[model samples]
Target chain A: MRNLVVLWMLILSMSIMAQMRDFQVITPELTGTLRLGLIRQNESLWLSDYKKIAAKKNGTETIYTIKHEWLNKGSIRISTKPLLDTHGFVMKIETTDIPASIHLFWAFGGCLGEVINLTGDENSLKPEFCKDNVFSIEGNSFTVYYGTSRKLRILEALVPPDSDVRLSDAHQQQTPLSFFNSGKKNDAPALAALTPLKNNEAVYFCFYKQNPKADYNYFMLPELYKKGSYEVHSETQWMKSTPD
Target chain B: MFKPLLIICFALFVGMYIKAATYNVKDFGAKANGKNIDSPAINAAILEAEKNGGGTIYIPAGEYLCYSIRLKSNITIYLESGATIVAAFPGAGKDEGYDAAEPNPDNPYQDFGHSHWQNSLMWAIGEKNITICGSGLIYGKGLTREESRLPGVGNKAIAFKECHNITLRDISMLRCGHFAVIATGVDNLTITNVRVDTNRDGFDIDCCRNVRITDCSINTPWDDAIVLKSSYGLRYFKDTQNVTISGCYVSGFDNGTAYTAQWETDEPQAPDHGFTVGRIKFGTESSGGFKNIAITNCIFERCRGLALEVVDGGHMEDLVISNITMRDIVNAPIFLRLGARQRSPKSTPIGAMRRININNINVYNADSQYSCIISGIPGHCIEDVSFSNINIYFKGGFTEEDGKRVVPENETVYPEPWMFGTIPASGFYVRHARKILFDNVRFHFAEKDKRPLFIFDDVEKSDISNIRVNGIKVENPFTAH
Candidate 1:
């Protein structure tokens, strides 16, 4: 009976999930780019939206950065050119500074939005940013005409930005290392014949792109006989003569 | 004379009492046409039988291409051998003043859309004790030459919305141009021994509870073979709880590399994802996520990525996967990833509390490009995952560099093409996970492969024990495929 009730509640909540709420995407920013001195000399690849309530990756939110915290709602507006590639008052921030309530403001829509061009006149920030609960941004550093003069946005957290954090070799030296690579050619015959390779349980395929230009980003797919994921089964303890 | 008449009347009364009441569509004169037919005559026959309180309405075998036929409570539509219900074209029979939907307290299905609401083959609403049995077939010939490409036209074989105690057995649903069979927002539904061959998803059970699917065969052209969806109506993630899929054979969805086209188009159209289970939508609706589904005793072949996924912001809990087998898959054997780092549900307070247990499985041959990917949010880790007693085979192997190990493709063939995408891995990889355990697991590859058997990123509280790796084949005696 209790299981039935729980299931009924689960079904009820699913209908609730289908119910919509009030939200909007208001801010945006594009951070870094593969710039070239040769052809068009593109300044940056737009990555994040400063106008959006949220930021992407490990970025800042619109609430913490505009010198004030602000909530977003539906029906937002976009300016033709924000910041300066610079001709007019392209950016204006109603809220000029980060607010006290916010923890971390996401950048771009979520990634850290880098506001580059503050031409002599044009601005992305609106004047009544804090009073009207909005912050418009404009930059002069790159070509942003290809982007939305204004686009929808989603607000996230307003976390302070930090540099990339890759782990140091503190544990690498202490931990034991294992390797399992089963590419083609190491067919079933080779796998069975290879000595000193038996009973080597647990396999992980580490996929890393040497550079950003690389297309291969190795991700996991499911297989019946491949036994791709590592697990500890509690129900079935009987061992079969399966090779790992 | 009077005494004789009384005996005759008594005998007639006894016969009427003994025989169960039955009504046939032929009694009311019904015809089955591929086009130009009314579903009401057959529906009326089913209802009259139910009004007489529970009986069977038999569909004689022939091609009856008709629009939505609403069902009633306490009824069983028995498809006598060779009965086939072909899906009628959408907007075909709406010319006259025909009213399809009217609200009724006795029927809660009225709150939901019509079965023909989107041009489905057979749809039922708010029905109870409904059983569709016998060796019949429902065909949605969406791939036909006379088909029209109209928007809002959904071609599904059978759709049951807000129904209860529904069972469909010994049936074949084929060539549903879009979705083959979908039972959404209903309860106590069981589908068994049904073979579905379709151009789209074979079977989809979304946003319901106590659903069981067993001993079924699903052959699909794209996306999941037997998919369990947690959300509906382009809304936020909805929790699809207590789903069990066992003893099923699945194949196909071998279309490769989804990044071949642009993400968005300027036209106003339904979002396209013949392959996506959950997606980020422009919020017109949202509530909770999905959780507590179990999939066991299944077989897979020629698939693309992880058959099980927690990609969208749906709530997932207690996902138990065991006794599985696989062979000749295109991509990694398992891919459990949160969407783009920024698009992860963490920032939006949408938690996908995922837990996976994969045990007693064998994977024969895996040839994947960029095999396994795990990219999830940091703080809201994909928690409580376990993989034990497993064996995997990656056909090719790798070699050790000056001090670093490198995959074979990194040096020769692939060389990391900027445009074509990257090459995948030969073994286990996890990211942003917590309470993860790996015991008695083996990853076997030859000595010529490059990649780590285990890689962790932004993970908290992980234990890897009883692990064995092959193809190390070095002098150190620590490495050996």
Candidate 2:
């Protein structure tokens, strides 16, 4: 009976940890549990202005399809599929009614630590991060964010290829949740402006619980044979074996 | 009327023939879905192109798992974007893997990988006007990084021997075993816009002439990025001459991280338990020599720095280097060694090192354990080397005892900086050298260091001027013998 109780307590702790890591919409404005916010501009439509049209499961993926009516002309449809394995999500927006711009804002409780822009630069040895919490991603396709909190969390945003998208850290003034609540309780949120998506487009955002480890053998190359399996012949031996 | 009809017929025939010159690998029964071995199909395409007096073998966008793709003369292998050639592992049987390493009678002097060229993913011997280009990837996923006599194992990614008029451009390589590209006894080589993130050496230009390497980014955490060698593997003393390397970036990042753009910095040390060894160097295998080489506008990051060595029995001369910048250097920013580790036949004498000019170098966050070393053997001295307009910043916390440490002359050993521990100088250490000049050189230390700025032992006819240490002017024109 005592061992059963210990096992139950272990299961309870695991459940609590998993729940804490789960990303969900915390506010009506679609503020994620990890402080990721979505804002649609050109009259500023939030998730609260949208209506959930459908939710379905498709092959190990739960996709939520939502729609927002803008100016009573047409409704924009957004399909968000959470990638459980990668701890990320892909949002596909399809509509003829294109907004002026869409942006993903991060309200990290004003605890943004470091931001690194990795684009065409592939020199891993000398990586340069932003200084003084100020960064510009003018010509970058990807960016990584780290929080100053003790929790080991990282956020990455990647722009889709061949898209007319620009990533920036500019401030967005749309809603109250778009502002970071520092200890002072009022600060501008870090913003990434992905402007002018076409009729159908998608973007990916990954919030990792921990830093991803680099895979040394990413292709799974085979190991070499042991040293004892072969003998290295010397010059004298090779010369003797050859016919002069 | 008959003559006009014959001319029209000939024009039509030529147009059709030109259109048939392109051989697509997919049309030749290559299942490029990363499943089946596609080397046989690729080789068949190459043979067909060669039979038609040379043509282009086009590989479209897919993953092709291959064993060995033999190269032929007058043929070009063009890979389209999103095309990847993955090296396939050898099955457990004889002749089940890549082509066997052909027997090399002149294999006594060099290592096994250098002695043979057949046992590789792609190889060419005695082929001219051959080119491999296009924005594709060569992933050595099944090649071994070790020297093994196993029947079904391959080592090198691309190995060329005795070839000429070669061009390799716009290709990216990852995790290439032993070497990403090794060109031996080849002439008129041009490599540009090639990116390689590998475990071992990136490019080994040995016994070649008229080589140009431009705009290459190579990252090798455990080995040299680009090393020029003149080994006796060809069984002849052919000097590597008239080479130029410019606009290159080399680094010692973890393998594959450069491609993925992750930039993981936790692992500061290499797997070999030495300092990360990704830098530009010349010779630990100088059997013939290097001449008329120029390197300019290069960058080094988180690795060793420029190393010019002629340890084997050869002559290294008439070299010029300019416009180099380094950051987070793990060892000496400049190492020039002329030693007597002659790994040649019985009658070969010691090599010579002279006539090297280096200018406009800047280094930051360098290790204080080793200063810039300019060393030679006891009886032989390196001659006529000059350094100008150089600046270096070191992470320093050395004591007086560390400054008084004695350096050993490992004459017959391999040439590397860490072979001698804790050099006594914090700026420069000179031994057995002559006609050396340091002009407008400056050194700065992050922490307190007790070593002198310059230490000379057996140095003759050296001129040091406009040298500063920690923003303070040192003795001007410090000359010693």
Model number with the top TM-score:
2
Candidate 2: regions farther than 4 A off? A1-244, B1-15, B476-481
Q: What ranges in model 1 sit over 4 Å off?
A: A1-244, B1-23, B26-28, B32-38, B90-93, B96-118, B142-154, B232-238, B253-287, B340-348, B397-424, B446-448, B470-481
Alpha carbon lDDT at B185, candidate 1: 71
lDDT of 2 by residue, B118-185 (tens): 88999999999999999999999878664444555688999999999999999999888889999999
For every candidate, the chain B TM-score is 0.74, 0.96
lDDT per residue as tens, model 1, B372-470: 444345555777888888777666544333114232211111111111133333455556678878777776653446544565666778887776666
lDDT of each: 0.42, 0.69
**Backbone clashes in model 2:** 0
True contacts kept of each: 0.00, 0.00
- For model 2, name the residue pairs that clash: none
> Residue-wise lDDT of candidate 2 within A1-244, one digit each (tens)?
1100100111221112111111232111112222223455533333432334344434423334444444234434433443322333434444555444544433322223333232312211111221112111212122232232122223333333333332222233244232322111112223333334455444433322111121111111111011101122231233211100
